[model samples]
Target: MSDSSFLNWPFFEERHRVLAAALEGWCASHLPVDHSDVDAACKGLVAALGAAGFLQPSGAGAGEKLDVRSLCLIRETLARHDALADFSFAMQGLGMGAVSLFGTEEQRLWLEKTRAGKAIAAFALTEPGSGSDVANTATLAEKVEGGYRLSGEKTYISNGGIADVYVIFARTGEAPGARGLSAFLMPADVAGLTIAERIEVIAPHPLARLKLEGVFLPESALIGKAGEGFKLAMSVLDVFRSTVGAAALGMARRALDEALARVQARKIQGEPLANLQMVQGHLADMALKVDAAALLVYRAAWTKDQGAARVSREAAMAKLYATEAAQEVIDAALQLHGGDGVRHGMKVEELYRDIRALRIYEGASDVQRVVIARTILGEAR
Candidate 1:
C-alpha cells in the first residue's frame, strides 16, 4: 500500500533511501500499538523506538545537526503505520528541539535520555489565550532570588502529563510582545507545576493543560539567552513543521492505498467498484494530491538541509499544503469505503481522526498564509 517511488526523487539522498527502507521494515513489526491507554501506549512506543535506534535522529549529538530529510522520512513511515507511533517519535524531537538547537553542554544531558527513549519530552508554547498569536503569550517568568519563578498556564501541550521535561516558553518582560519571551527547560516534578486538566482530542494523544503557581528554575534551566524564546521557538518550528507535513503525507498515502484496495475489492452492480469511471477519477485525484504534497514536503525539507538559514516560507507552504491535501485525500478514501470507512477498527477511520490535528497544530493553515504573505510583502518592500 505504501509508495516507495517518491524515495527516488532528487530531493532525497541514498542515505535517506536506506533509512526509509530500514524504518519501514521496523514499523511493519512494531507499530499500531494498543491505544486503549494512550499514555502508556505512547511511552511504550517511545521506548521501543529508542531501543531500536530509530529515535537517534530525533535529537542531535555534539557538533551534529538534525537531518531534516531523515526526520521527515522517519515521521512519514511511522505515521503510515501508526499515528501514535509517529506522535511518539515526533514529540521527542519537538520537545527537545530547543535544547538540540541552542542548549548549553550541561542542558543537553536531557537529550541523551530523550534520544535514548528513557524519558518523555514536551514542548509547552501554546497558552489558553494565545493560540497562534504567540506574541500574546501571557505566561510570566519573574526573576527571583536565585532563579526565575514561572507562573502561567500552558494548554494543549503535547506529552504534557507524562513528560519528564518540557521546553516551556514564558514572558520575561525584557521588551514587549514576542521580544520579551524566553524558553526554559522545566522538569515536570518541579514545585508549583500542576497538570490542571488532561485534554482529550478527536485523536487520543497525550495532551494536557498545565498551571504553574510558581515553578522555580535555576539559572541553568534557561534555554539560549533571555528574550530569545520566540526566536528559539520559531527556529525549532522551522525544522519540525515540515516533518508534520511528512506525517500527513504518510497518512494520505495510506488513505490512497486503502482506497485503491477497497475499490478493487468491493463490487457494485456485479462489478468491482474500481471499474467505475468516477471511481477511477477519484483515485486519480487522490494520487495527484499525494504526489503534489510529497513534492512540497520534500522540497521544504531539502531546502532546509541545504543550509538556508531559515525555511520559514517553504516550511509553512509545505505544512499547509500537505496537511490540507492529506485531509482531502483521506476523506476521499473514506468516502470510497462507503460505510466501512467510518466503521470501528478501520484504518481509514483512525486516519480520518489523525489527519485533522495536523492542520491546527504547529501553525494553523491561516497562520501559514499570513507568514507567507508577510515574507513576500517584506521582500517586496
Candidate 2:
C-alpha cells in the first residue's frame, strides 16, 4: 500500500526510515481493529503509542526540538493504520505544540506527563463564531488581581472534555483583532469552567464545547506574551499543518491499496474488474494523486526541517492539495468497493469518513488556497 520508494528520497533521513518501519510494525500488532469504546480506545492508543516510544517524536521532553520529517512520517503511518490512532497522536502534538515551540521552563513541565500518556492535552482556539478567522476571537480574558478571568466559549475543541491541560486563545483587550488575542495554558478542572457539550461527529474522538464563566488563572499561564498569542498560534499551526497533509497522503495511499486489491480480486461479467479499462484508469489516477500528494507533503516538511524561517506557503499548498487529493482518492476507492464500500465495518467505509475531516480542520481548504495565493501575491492573510 505504501510507496516505500518515497522514503528513499532525500527528504528523509535513515533514522526517519527506521522510526517509520518500527512504528508501522507496532501499529499492526497493537492498534485495535475496532474502536467501539471510542473514548477508552483513544486513551489506550495514546498510552500504547507513548509506551512504544513513538510518542517521543512529539518532542515533549525538555530541550528537544521537533523534527518535522519524523512527525510527518509517524502521522502518515498512523493515519494509514487507524484514524483514531492518528487523531490521538496529532492532538497530543498540537495540544503541546505551543509549549514545545515557545513555552518557558515552568510552562512546559507538563510535557513530560503529556508525552508519557499520563496526561491528556488539548488545543482550544476555535470558537463558535471564528474558526479560520482567528483574529475574530470572541472568548474574553479580562485582567484580574492574580491573573485573568476567562469568560466565553470554545467549540469543536479536540480532546476537550478529556484534556488535562489546554493551550487556549482569548481576547485580552490589549489590542484589537489578532493582536488582542492571548494564548494560555489552562487546566481542564478550572473552577469556573465547564464542558458545556460533548460533540458527536461522523468520526469522533473526544470533541467538545467548553464554557468558562469566570475561570481564574495565575499570570504564569500565559504562553509567550499577551499580544503575542496570534503570532504564537500561527507558528504552531505552521508546523502541524504540513503533517496534516502527510496524514491525508497516508489515507490516500491506503485507499489506493484497497482499490487495487478489490479490482483484482472481484469478478465482473465473466472477467476481473481489474481487466476493465475504466477501472484501470481509476487505479492509475488514484496512484498518481497519492504520489503527487506525497511529494508536496514531504517537500514542505523537508523544507521546514532545513531551518527555513517559515514554510507557510509550502505548508498551505501541501495541506490543501493532499487533503483534497485524499478525498478524491478515497471516494474512488469507495466506488471500486461498490456495495461493500458503504457497509458498516468496512475499511473503505471508515477511510471515506476519515478523509473528509482533514479538509476542514487546521485551516480549511478554502482558507489554505487564500493563504497560498496571498504568499504568491506578496500579501499577508
Candidate 3:
C-alpha cells in the first residue's frame, strides 16, 4: 500500500509486485483497528488473509516447493499495515511449514487443510528448560507397539491454545542431545494433549503452554526421519527468520511514516516541526536505518530464493539487523510524536509494543548475534 520500491528489487518478479499491490489494498479494507477481543481479531484476520489469498505464499505449493521471496514480501506488507495480521498469516505458514517441507503426502494433505484456514496450525518446540538450547529438550516420545507415546510439555507456544493441529518435537533416543529427537503431527483433540496455560506478553496474541501426557501419535504422524526433527525445525526457521525481519521492516516503515506525518503537520516554536534542523537530522537517521534493514532482509530472502539450502548466516544477519534497527527507528518515531506517541490508542504506541516482541521471538537478538558469529567463523575455517 505504501509503495512498490521493495518489490522492484531484483529479488521479486512481476507476480510478486502484483501480489504486493493486491494484498495492500485488501489489508487497507480488511484490518480491524478495534482491539476488543484479541483472539477473535486474530481469527478474523486469518480468515480474511486466507480469503484474500495472501496466506498462500507462506507455504510450499502443492508440489512441495516454496517461494521464500514471496513469503518475505507478504510479511513486509502485512506487517506494515498490521502486525497482528502479519502474525496470523505467518503462523499459518510456520506452524505447518514442516509438513510443507518434509511431510509425506498425507502430511501435505493435512497442511493443505490448515493452509486453507479450515484448521489452525502450531509449532511446539520450546520447553521449560529449552529455549535456545533445543537439544536440551526433555520432552520424550517413546516408541510403542502401534505408535509413539509423547510425554512432555512445550511452553511459549504460539497459537498453542487455539490451534487445531501442532507439529511437536520430542526426544526419542537415549543419546544425550538433539540426535534422538523426532517431530510429530499431533492434533488438539488427541487424548492426553492439553493447553496448560495461556501465556500473555507485552503484545498479546494467542500464546500458551502445552502439556502432553502419553499422547499417542501413530507412526504416520512422524515428519521426516527420526533424529531429523532438529534439522527440520532449523530448516524451517532458516526460511521464516528472514521473513521475521521483513515483518520488522514493515513495522519500521510504518513508524517512519507516522513520524513523517507528525513532523510535517505538528507545529512547534511558531513553525512546523519539519522546519527544525534537529528534526530533519532524526528523520535522516531513521531513513538510513530503515533502508539498511530493508537491504539485509531482502538480501537474505533473495539468497534463500536462489536455492541456498541453509541460510543461517544470512538469515541471522537479516533478523538481527532489521529487528534491532527497527527498534531504534520506532523509538525515534515515538520521540517525534512527543506526548501523542505514548497515547493509549496511538498507532505508534501499539507499534512500540508490537516491535518489541520481534526482537525476542523467532530468535532473540543475542541468539542471532551468536548465530551470525558462528557462521562467519565457521566459513573462515
Candidate 4:
C-alpha cells in the first residue's frame, strides 16, 4: 500500500515493476497473518512459495542466471506483508547463494530441489567463538580417509535445526587468518551432526546452534575449492547484503503505512491527529527516511545486476543506511502510535521488534561502517 512510483527509477526495469506488483498481490492473498512456531511456519512458507513459483530466483539452472533485482523485489514485497515470510524467502536465496554463484552441476542439483521447496538450505559461517572475525573460525575440517572430518560449533545459524542442507565453513589448513578455510555442503542427516540448541530472540525466527562433533563429510560435500571458504562466504554476503537492505526498506514502508493510517484515523484534542504540526513532522521524517533507504537499496541492487563482479562497497552502504534508517522510521511510527504502539499485537509494535534484527544481522551496522571506511580509504579493494 506504500508508494509504487519508486519502481520507475532507473534502477528498475519494466520486468521489476511487473514482478513487484505480482508478488505484492500474491503476498496480499497469502501472507497477511503472523506465525507462532517460527520453524514450522518457515518450512510451510518455503513450500508454499516454491509451489507458487516464486523461489526460482534463488537458484540458477543450466540456461538460467540469478537476477539480483528480482530477488530484491520479492523480498521487499514479501517483507511488506510479513517478515517471517520474508525470512522464509530470504533464506532460500541466501542459503543457496554460494551454490547459485559457484556450485558445480551436482551442487546445482541440490539448489534446484531447494528452489522447488523439496529441501531447505542453511548458511553456517558464524561460529560460537567467531563471527565478524571469520579468520578466527574454530570449526575445523580435517582431511581424512575418504573425505573430511568436521568438528566444532556454528551459532546463530538461520534455518539451523530444520534445514535439509547446510553450506558450512570450516578450517581445512593452517594458513593464517582467512586463508585456510573451505566451504562444504553437508546434509542435515549426516552422521555426528546435531542441533545443539535453539535460540529464541525478541523477534522470533528459526535459529539454532549446530555441533558438528567430528562429522565426516564425503569429498563431494565441498562447494568451491579448498581455502576459498572465506572468499566464497564474503562473495555470497556481498550479493545478498543488498537484498537484506531491501527487506528493511519494506518493513520501513509498512511502518510508514501503519503510521499514516493511525494518524489520519486518530484525533488529538478537537481536530484530527494529522492536523497537528508535531504529528505531521513525525510523518515527514518517516517518509523521508523510507525514500532515502529505498534509493540506496535499489541502487545497490541495480549496481550488482549491471555486471559488477563485486558490489561490496555499495552493498555495505545500502545495508548500513537502510537498516539504521528503518530503526528510526519504525521508532517514529511507534511514537506516533503513543501507548498503542507498545500494546501487544499492534502492527507498529511488531515492526519495532522486526526492524531491530535487521541492523544486527548479515553484518552489524558497525561492521558495515568499517567496511565502508576501508573501501573509501583504499584499505580494501
lDDT of 4 by residue, 1-381 (tens): 689999888888888887888788888788865487777889899998999889988877766767888998888888888999999989989999889888888888899899998899999999878888889998999999889999999999999999999999999984877999999988899989999999999899999999998899989888889988999999999999999999999999999999999989988787789999988898998899889988888888888888899888999999999999999999999998999999989988998999898988899999999999989989545
Cα lDDT, all candidates: 0.95, 0.90, 0.87, 0.90
> TM-score of every model?
0.99, 0.98, 0.98, 0.98
Error of 4 at 94 (Å): 0.8
Give model 1's TM-score versus the native structure: 0.99
* Clashing pairs counted in every model: 0, 0, 0, 0
Q: Is candidate 1 or candidate 3 better by TM-score?
A: 1
Better of 1 and 4 by TM-score: 1
Mind sharing the TM-score for model 2?
A: 0.98
lDDT of 3 by residue, 1-381 (tens): 254576677777898888878877887787644557778888777777777667777677556578888888889888898888888889998999898888888888767766677778889999999998889989999999988999989999998888888999999894668887889998899999988999988888999999999999999999999988888899999989999999999999999999999999999877999999999999999999888998899888889888888899999999999999999999999989999999988989989999998988888999999999888898899
Candidate 1, residue 291: lDDT: 92
Off by over 4 Å in 3: none
Which regions of candidate 4 deviate over 4 angstroms? 379-381
- Cα deviation at 317, candidate 1, in Å, is 0.6
What ranges in model 1 sit over 4 Å off? none
Tens-place lDDT per residue, model 2, 1-381, is: 466888899888899889988987898897644688888888888888888778777754566778999999999999998988999899889999999988889987878778887788899999999999999999999999989999999999998888899999999978879988999999888899899999999876799999999999999999888988999999999999999999999899989888888999999998999999999999999989998999999999999888888999999999999999999999999999999999988889999988888999999999999999989889642
Top model number, lDDT: 1
